[model samples]
Target: MYSICRRIIFLETVAGVPGMVAAMTRHLHSLRRMRRDYGWIHTLLEEAENERMHLLTALHLKRPGPFFRACVILGQGIFVNFFILSYLISPRFCHRFVGYLEEEAVITYTKCLNQIDRGYLPMWAKMDAPDIARTYWQLKPDAKMRDVILAIRADEAHHRLVNHTLASINPEQKNPYKPGE
Candidate 1:
């Protein structure tokens, strides 16, 4: 369970980075082109924020050790650059990658929930959801850690679907810098 928790925390930290890089890159592209992003900036940034909240909630569950935190920093740094380059090269491919990432997140969280339910992972008797999580997610007063996990999984599923759909549509066709063209 400890390892699983660490994995989720690490995953969440890395997960948050791609959306931010894509959002920032898109914002720069939009600004350079003197055109609106048509709402993708907001959606991607919101996804980043949601992923960040998941990281924070996991932190509340267990403060990661120094080694773990270092790995997270390194992982995020590397992943951010890779994702930004990928997005610049091909937004459709980048979105597809994010969709895959979100699908994995949903699966991971579901596994965690199952572990908790099966008593393989011992949770607090009355663990309350993190205040940040509750506020960010607008969760009810009775929300617990399990509830938070479920909500995060649901959000990831939604992101997965959205990114998959966006990848299929390829809305950034209007951008002049179509790589490989």
Candidate 2:
């Protein structure tokens, strides 16, 4: 349980990076070309915000100490730079990478949910869903931790599909989610 929670915390910290990097690079690209980004800017920025909420939710569950916080800072610094460079070089590859990360997040959250269901984590036995999660997802007041996990998993799945679809589309094509002509 400790290990699982630790992994979730660390992963969530890194999880928010790609979307932010993508949004930043895309925004700069759009500015340089003096054209709209279609809808990628908003979508990517929203993705970053959602991932930050996930990190916030997880932090409510587990508060790591200074050492772990330092690790998270270092890791995120490295990852942000790497992802920024990667996106600049090949946006499609960056999208594919984020898609894969979201896929892994879904799997990890599922395993966490399974552990909670199996009575392995006593702390999670009757955990209330965080208010931030409920508000972000607009869940009922009665929603529990498991419900929040499910919601997060669904978000990851959606992100995975969106990123993968983006990766496969031609760069010259307009954004897939753009307003209709």
Candidate 3:
């Protein structure tokens, strides 16, 4: 249980990066070019926020040690710079990369859910969703960890779809999905 939570916490930290970098890049480009970003910024910002929520939710389950924290700081530093440079070079490639990562997130969360259901993660199988998870996902007050995992998986699927869709279109094109969609 701790292992899975730790992995998820770390992954979410990294996963939140692209959206922020992409959004900021687009915003700056728009301002420089004297045009709007169509509707991508809102969605990208939302994606970043959602991933932050996921990280917060996982942290509620398990706090990392100092060594793990150091690793996160270093990893985030490297990933943020990599994403900034990558997005500047090719936004489409960055979005596609994020889509691929989201696919892995879905798979990891599914595996965690399966482990819980199979009685391997007994602690999580019996635990209730954290209040933050319940509020963010709008889950039942009595929702369990399984319920939270399901919500996260659904979110990951949505992000995968959105990123792939974004990758297929031109950066200046109007975003097909509306803000908060």
Tens digits of per-residue lDDT, candidate 2, 88-163, equal 8999998998899899999988888898899887677688888998998999998888888898899899889878
**Cα deviation of 32, candidate 1, in Å:** 1.1
TM-scores for every candidate against the unseen true structure? 0.89, 0.93, 0.98
Order of quality (TM-score)? 3, 2, 1
Candidate 3 regions off by >4 Å? none
Which predicted model would earn the best TM-score? 3
Clashes of 1: 0
Write one digit per residue (lDDT tens) for candidate 1, span 49-95. 88888888888878888898788788878888888888899988988
Better of 1 and 2 by lDDT: 2
Candidate 3 per-residue lDDT over residues 86-124, each given as its tens digit: 999999999999999999999999999899988999998
* Candidate number that wins on TM-score, 1 or 3: 3
lDDT for residue 73 in candidate 3, whole number 0-100: 97
lDDT, candidates in the order shown:
0.81, 0.85, 0.92
Candidate 2 residue pairs in backbone clash? none
What order do you get sorting by lDDT, best first?
3, 2, 1
